[model samples]
Target: MIRFICCLILLSISTLVSAEEKLLHADFRHRPPEMIVENNRAAGPLKDVLDEAADVIGYKIEWRIAPFARSLKGLKNGKVDLVPRVIKTSQREKFIDFLGPIGHRQKDIVFLVRKGKEKTINDYHDLYKFEIGIKRDTAYFTKFDADQALHKILLLDDRNMSSMFAAHRFDVMVVLDKDSIESAFKQKDFTDYAYADYKHKQNIGIFYGLSKLSANTKVNAELSRILLDMSQSGRVAQIYQNYKLEAPLRLF
Candidate 1:
């Protein structure tokens, strides 16, 4: 009886130690080769850093994978605890706590059109005459849609939106320069196409979306320390490099 009790006590202590560790939930919606789903697994630069960050912090991660809308809902309802990459916006501040930035300030939108229509998009002023594809409800799209000067907007989901661009269904599509380049590269096409400037420059910050708890402030401070240490020691760069991503943009 004494030996059995000792074994039980040790097991209980082990469980207690594990329960004290934190769990971070991470999610992303972009498709491959940037954010690819393969053999029931997600892989890319974002996932690489997230996995490393969780390991570094001694925390386990419960990953959520879905379309953009579903992932946003997960973050809002507290169904998930973290989002690997999100562009910080004033409206989103109410829901998520952020970590270090993973991408940079994308200054201009690259306009992709059918092969022969390159000359049509000369500048932002030319946008008024063309039908442009924009992802509805995204921070950048929302800001762009609200401006009275830019009219004739056509909204679509990112996947369908990209398909339309490739099919020549639209004259021009406004997308982030990096994302446009990434998409073309993923399709194994390296050719450049028509593009023009979108005056508004956005600062994209990739962060962990912590659940709102009474202990949130304390949680953020702790997470920040882990991220800062990762940044200073080049752990962040190493993780991104492993997945073939550029070193993360420093916002904080």
Candidate 2:
């Protein structure tokens, strides 16, 4: 009887372990007000939304911090299942299946310059004369990328680029939006920088990229449904409000 009971207990434990949902892995950078990582945990409006969606979909997320390029490589190599904040591109579509516009609002790629230099960058053409700092391997806009005459200083990431811009190493730095500028300023404890709005504005949609090889279609479908429901039920908007961010345009 003792032997039979032990076998039964062992079988139950194995069944429980097998019944647990598969763990999903994702990568992120320290993009604040959208995605922020501190003490090895991710937070922010988008992160909160993702957490809620995962709960509803019955899965676990394992977030890893890595550079954007390395994260992209991980997705291609099937080592990472998802990237929480990615802008879709024709090239990226080959390996990544975008889930949804997880961000609450559209992001505008604008120029961040010292307060007194705003007038100098009135248009895209004016940017040609200044030394501009940009994040390496990031897309600002089609026009900005196609312009070969503009002088650009490519930096590794936002934090590094912001530090260089604060030190006045470059005349201007291109950032995602006003929130990005504010986040950078808060991180560096400097608020003298201002954003320049030009004619060429890129309204980028941020999404969660699921690796085509590793992501299960059925699980992704369920996650998509949960996200859509959250958006419709105003949960997504409430999450953004909690973080003091403007809610994304409703697309129900």
Best by lDDT: 2
Candidate lDDT (C-alpha), each: 0.63, 0.77
User: For model 2, how does the per-residue alpha-carbon lDDT over 36-92 read when each residue is reduced to its tens digit?
Assistant: 778877788777777778877777778788888888888888888888778788878
Error of 2 at 65 (Å): 2.8
What is the lDDT, from 0 to 100, of the residue 130 in candidate 2? 91
Tens-place lDDT digits, model 1, residues 1-252: 999999999999999988886676667665544466666677886677666766766777677667666666777787766766666666777876776654454444466665566677676677788777766555564556566776545554566665666666666777654563456445645343555543445555556566453232355666666766777777877876777767756655
- TM per candidate comes to 0.74, 0.84
Off by over 4 Å in 1: 1-22, 31-34, 102-107, 141-145, 148-156, 177-203, 211-218
Q: Of the candidates shown, which would achieve the greatest TM-score relative to the real structure? A: 2
Cα shift from native, residue 203, model 2 (Å): 3.2
Q: Please list all clashing residue pairs in model 1, or write none if there are none.
A: 99-207
